[model samples]
Target: MTDVQTDTTLCDPQDMAGRLHTALSDLVRDCKARMLRPRPGHQPTADLSGFRLGITWLAQQRQMDSMLDLAEQLVREAPALVGGHGRKPETLDQLRACMVPVLRALPEVNRPPAQRLEWLFGTLLVDELQCLPHAEVMAVLERNAFQPRHWQYIVPYLEQNLPKVKGTGLSWQGQERRRRLLGYAWQACQKAGWADRAEALFRRELSVCACYGELAELLVHRGDVEEAQTVLLKGIAKYNASRPELTMGWLDRLESLNGVG
Candidate 1:
C-alpha cells in the first residue's frame, strides 16, 4: 500500500498568517499599479467587496492581529488608492467600500485612542464628504462617542453635504438618507455641547429641504418660540395638501406652542 501524505500546511496558523500577508500585499500592489497606470476613461477599481470578505474570514478565524494589520495597511493606503486628480463617482464608491470595514474594525482593535483618532481625522475624514456618503459615515459616528475634535470634521461635512440633500436631482431614497444623516448630525452636535452648530445645521437644512418640523423643534428647545411658530405655520401650509400626516403633526406642535391644546 502506498503511504498517504496529509496536507498539514492548510491547518498551520503560521503558514496561514504568511499566506494572508502575501495575499494582501499582492492585492495592494495590484491596486497601486492600476492607480498609477490608468487607461483613458477607465476608472481604477479596487476589489473592495473581496477585501471585506477576507476581513470577515479573518474575523471568523479569530485572527484579531491579522485583522488589525489589514486595517492599518488600508488606512495608510486609502488616500493614495482613491484620492487625487480626476476622481470619478466610481472611485468614491470604492473608497466608501474600503473605509467602511476599516471604520467598523478600528474601534475593536487594540490600538491607542490617539492613534485611532489620528487615523479617523487625518486619513479618513480628510475631504470625507467627497469620499463617503452621509448615511454610511454617520452610522459609524452614531455607534461611537463623539470626541470634541470631531467637530472640526463634522461641521464642514454637514455644511457641504446638507445643501446637496435638496434640489440636487436626488431620488426620494437619496433625499431620505440625507435627511436621516441630518437628524443624526443634529443630535451629535447637541451631544457635543455644540448647540450653536446644531442650530446652524438645522437652519442650513431648512434652507435646502424646508425641514420645518425639525428646525422648529430645535428652535423650541432653544426658547425661540416665535420663530418655531412661524416655521410650523409654514410647514402646515406647505405640506398640508401633499403630506396631511406631517401637517397634522406640525399642527399639534403649533397648538402646543400657542397653548391651545
Candidate 2:
C-alpha cells in the first residue's frame, strides 16, 4: 500500500564535495569580513542559503572528514563574528540568526564525540552563551547524549542557571520553562551522584508545579512505595475532574507499582 520514488541519475561525489567546500569557504570569508569591518547603522548578514542542505547532503554521503573540516572552520570563526559587537542584544540576535545552521550542524560533525562536548560546554555554553537563549542552549544538550565526564560542566551550569530561571516574574509560560529547567537540574544532580541535591530539587519542583505524578515517580524510584502510592492517589483525586486522561495514566502507573496489573 506504499509508493516510493527513486533517482537513477549518477552524480559525482567529488564535484558535490567541491561545491560544498566552496560554499562553506565563502561563508567563512563573509563572516570574517563582516566581523573585521562593520558598517554603521546596518546589521551584518551572512547568507546561509543551501548551507544546511549542503551539510546534510555531505553527511548523507558519509564524507565525515570533509564535514568536520567545514564545521571547525565555522566553529572557529563564528564566535568572533557573533561577539564582535560586544553583546548588544539586537546585534547578537542578528548574528545568532545567521549562525543557527552552523550551530545545529556542529554536534553532528565533531569527531571523537568528546570533541563535540568540548565545543558545546567550553565554547557555546560559555563564550557564546550571551548570544543564545537558554532554550536554544538546552536544545543542544537535549540533542546529544553525554557521559559522566560531562557532569563536571553540566552540573555547575545547571546549578548556576536554575536560580536565575526561578527568579523570573510570575508568568505561566515562564513558570513552565522553569519547571522544565528544574527537571534538567534534578536529572543532572542525580546523574552526578548527588542524590540529596536531586531529591531536594524534585521536592522543590513538586512544590512549584504540584505535578504529583512526577513526585510519586521519584518516591517510587527511591523505594518509598507507600509514600508514592499516597502521592499518586492524591494526584488522581486532584486531576480526575480537570484532567481525566492524566488521572487515568497515573492510575495505571500506581496499579503497576502495586502489582495490581
Candidate 3:
C-alpha cells in the first residue's frame, strides 16, 4: 500500500466491524454456556456484561453456521429466564464463523484485492496453510493486500512453508516494513568490514536468514577472497546444521557468483 492507502486502512470501519463480530460472537457463546445452570427457572440476576454481549451478538454476529443450532436453543428457551425479560436469542451469524474451513480459500489472486484481504483476516485463525493446497497458498501470497495484518500472518507463513522468509526484519513500523528490513540487512553487511559480522548479528537479533552470498561479498570487498570463502562456507555449514535450506541457498549463490553454475 502507498502512504495514502496505508493511512486509510488504519481507520477502516468495516474491518473493525468484522473483528467486532468475532469478539461479540465469542462473548455471546460464552454467556450462553455460563448460564447453563440446572433448573431452568433458577435465573441469576441480569448482568450488564451479559446484556451488552447479547445485544452486540444479536446485532453484529455473522457466519459460523455451527452455532445456529445453539442460538435456536437459546431463543426457544429465552422465555424461561425472568431476568432476561422474555426475549428470544437471534440466529447465530454464519458469516461470523471464523472456522477452519474458510481459511482454505485463496480468493485474493482471482478476486478483488479487498475481498481477498477480508477472507485472509478471517482465515488468520485457521491452522497453517498445511491444510490448504500448496497451489492455493502460493496464489494468495502472490497477490497484495492493503491489510498489514495480512503481513502478520505472512511472515510466520513464509517461515513455516519456505524457510526463505527469515529476514533481519523490518524496523519500519508503518507500512513498507519489508523494504526497511532489506535495507537494514544490507547496511549491516556493509558496516561489518566484510566480516559478515553484520549479517551474523542480524540473523542472531532478528532470526531472519542472512542473505544468500552476502558473506563472501563482504570478504571480497576487503581483499580476502580465500578467508571470506572459508568464513562463508563455515558459517553456512553451521547455519545448515540448523537451517539447511538457508545454507543451501547461500552455497548455491556462492557457486553461481563464481561461474561454477
Highest lDDT among the candidates is held by which one? 1
Candidate 2 regions with alpha-carbon error over 4 angstroms: 1-51, 54-149, 163-183, 259-261
Q: What TM-score does structure 1 among the candidates reach? A: 0.50
lDDT of 2 at 162: 54
- Scored by lDDT, model 3 comes in at 0.38
Q: In candidate 3, residue 191 scores what lDDT?
A: 30
lDDT of 3 by residue, 1-261 (tens): 011122222444344344444544554555456546334654344322332233233233332232222323333333233213223222122222222123333331355544454344223223221222334434454544434453433333332333233221332221123323333334323432333444444344333434434545655666766755666676686677776855686677566556321
Write one digit per residue (lDDT tens) for candidate 1, span 167-192: 23244444444555566667657756
Relative to the unseen true structure, what is the C-alpha lDDT of residue 138 in candidate 2, on a scale of 0 to 100?
A: 69
- Global Cα lDDT for candidate 2: 0.56
| Per-candidate local distance difference test | 0.59, 0.56, 0.38
Q: What ordering of candidates by TM-score runs from best to worst?
A: 1, 2, 3
Worst 10 residues of 3 by lDDT: 91-100
Q: For model 1, state the Cα shift of residue 45 in Å.
A: 26
Count of backbone collisions within predicted model 1: 0
